[model samples]
Target: MPLPTGSSQPVYYVGWDVGGWNCDANPASRDALVVLDDALNLVGTPWRGNLRTTLNEARDSRDLIDRLLGLCRHQAQGAEHVVMAIDTPLALPRALLALARGDAVSALGRSQENPYLYRETERWLFQRGITPLSPIKDMIGSQATKGMHLLARFAPHIAACGQWLSDDRTLTVVEGYPSPAKRSPAFAALRQRVNMPATLETMLHQPTPKQQDIQDAWLCALLAWSLRHAAQSVAWPPDSMPAEEGWIFVPVDSLTPPV
Candidate 1:
């Protein structure tokens, strides 16, 4: 029997949340890739693979670039536009990078400088009506610092992609995270304050199968689609003013505050 061909979609976006190690250390360190359709539905099961060891060891940025391009080729097979949101830092805005290099009380207060930089960046985004996709953490939680580090690296990557897609406005890469923390009320409140959408389960209670990183990648893809379609503001240089802005895709339904 012949199988029916699926209908074509206007665009496809893929997001990858690169991790130091796999879900279980026994599995080995592998990058997690998630593919999403234009409708923001999970189009395919996530795939896991080794990080480009050659690039990591050789310090060859090209290897990473090549690997990402190849992933695009595979996931974007027939799509007109493809956006890839990576979970690593791509390029930092000149201003923020400068701040990181500077010595300020707030910046120097942290154990690591990266968190300070991210904290500043988040403030910058929020002021501009742009909500950053970052994990929320409690004041005393150990994970807060880790979440800040993730943003410090990932934000720049998303910005770089924004620069690349400035021309066509078709391809957008963003940073994101899942909402409604299972164990962190402080975190959940923060996401809500930012107007980030949470599922009913997330709003009412935390759900299991908690792969927050994977969910973040999926969110990034959704944001990319929104940017391409003018659902979200697209800011580049020259034509649009260059500001330290982080992109997030809030579901239309989620944009409104909860009653």
Candidate 2:
């Protein structure tokens, strides 16, 4: 599938399903990646593997960073805006951090703001019927940390509005939760009403573990696309939400896919 022509600078959307730190040893648990163009067409063949090979091949830290950029580029031939959506917790709760510092914090008993388990973003999703997992209480600490590590290396600067901006200001990174996002009204509408690529059907019917990862990556890519193109539909966190806590980007039911 090809993107719509005529735009001088193409925008590439990347969705990455983070795996364990040592994902190379486990094929079923390897990280999955999906790249999409502005029109939502697959950019290249989806990739399932870890960063071991890329890191090993590089001569130094700078070379490693270059190789990582190449991996995200895939087959794209020119400079483009890259928006990577990762399915993992990018930050921990503020209250938990405060407590970790041995501050006198009051208990959050039964309150949705459980510092040890839930971030404000997760609680916000819970109020809207989407349950996001916790890195502290859940078994996803490895993946969560992996995502954050990548963010620190690639786009450590957080914008005032909470967007993760790359050092060069070309790449923008966002957090995503595909489990609840796939069930969102926006996804349902996109699946049933949008003019999607033909490969989408094959992906939809298959339920294998690796396939699920790819599907999740694709959904995350969709969120990235929506955030870039359909801003009105994106569920932007309130200004009150701390930029350091991080925010998950997902479109609401009002999303209208570009023609």
Candidate 3:
């Protein structure tokens, strides 16, 4: 289970298992993060805590950026790209975004578009027999609220960065989903045998992966690694995937469900 580093540029992947708006996330609460270097090895150290604790508050967004930049600094001269794969909806559906932005009544009309309530990428995953909760519905649960706030605060920074593994860029963020794959029967079998970090693997075997946020963060990093080095992924609606809505990277084959 060695990680790859064939690419010339140094890219670090970070995984964030987001918490809620009530300030109720921590290592014990299934919200955590992990960092992996270009060679897929741990960088500095993986951490777990409440997003509210790190992020502080909406106006305190700089705290989050400062922390991330510090992580990027772990590499030399900030030449590395930090591809953050966050296990939360990095962006909301267009209608919702509109509603959030004060187009309250206008968004109701477009509701007919994604009448099924799922985002485009979400629908695409469903077509492939993968199921993910609707960001709309999940938003009500507070996790989406926490993530959306960060996206707004960090959008400018992310926008200014490069696409993919750009050397000039210090950060590139993407959406990530680990639940569908983890819930699959195939992954269940591998829980007994797969060779990942011992602590993470053991967490996967728990009755409820409720406290496996750290492990999920590690998987997020692995997904980013596979996408960068191997390019083994499944992106739906190839012709047009909206940047505003965000895309989830699910690595093909073994990464999808442990073998």
Candidate 4:
């Protein structure tokens, strides 16, 4: 489970579980974030809050970046590459966009191939028995838009179907879906193999929404790590998928539902 890096500099994996823009109104909701080093060690205590407050307090874009980085708490200060995996839809379905622009869309009969709601990546998940929430169909538009806002300010350069790299190439942002992974036997085995930290283990047993957010954040961080080092463990989007409709990186073993 130890990830060896080719670069001498350390790589940090971040997981963000996006919530509504204003978490103050919702007691159970929180935008949780967790950080892990290449070695799978927790970098800092998990942070549970909204970015709206941080944005309102920031002086400028640079200051906002610093504020966002500060959430990493003990993240190493020196040369580092950060890959942030977010649990939310990063882009809208292409067909949904076309429909929005007053176009006729077909293929509405089947649940999996519905072009207006599910993206290619989402359909891929459906074929594998993992049901994904549509940003348009589901009521998670707030969460999805919040994730997009984060991508806008941090990593706006799309490198592929599901990835966005920063201007200086120091940061990479990718979409992550942790619900399936959280239920996978493979992930349970992985937790045992990696010797998941005590704090994270404790978070898993708690039934509260706040704790769930933290657990998902940790899983997303692990997804980022797998994308970097254990690529085989990740289900990457196929080339045929459109770049406009981003991909969701899920654990390979999570493709099949647990019986």
TM-scores of all candidate predictions against the true structure: 0.46, 0.83, 0.68, 0.88
Please provide, for model 3 over 16-100, each residue's C-alpha lDDT reduced to its tens digit, 9 standing for 90 to 100. 8777655453334545777776665666555655666555542433335447545434434434546777777655566566666
lDDT of each: 0.40, 0.71, 0.56, 0.78
lDDT agreement of model 1 with the native: 0.40
Cα displacement (angstroms), candidate 4, residue 66, comes to 4.1
Please name the candidate that would achieve the greatest lDDT relative to the true structure: 4
Question: How do these models rank on lDDT, best leading?
Answer: 4, 2, 3, 1
Q: Return the top candidate by TM-score.
A: 4
Candidate 4 residues 25-130, lDDT tens each?
A: 6768778888877777777678888877785675543444455568767634545677889999999888888888899675477866798888989988888889
Q: Which scores higher on TM-score, 3 or 4? A: 4
Error of 4 at 151 (Å): 1.7
The superposed Cα distance between candidate 3 and the true structure at residue 80, in angstroms, equals 3.8
* Backbone clashes, candidate 2: 0
Candidate 4 TM-score over all chains jointly: 0.88
TM-score of 1: 0.46
lDDT of model 1 at position 5: 30
| Model 3 lDDT, full chain set | 0.56
Once fitted onto the true fold, the runs of candidate 3 whose alpha carbons sit more than 4 angstroms away are 1-9, 25-30, 56-66, 69-79, 97-116, 139-141, 157-168, 183-210, 234-237, 254-259
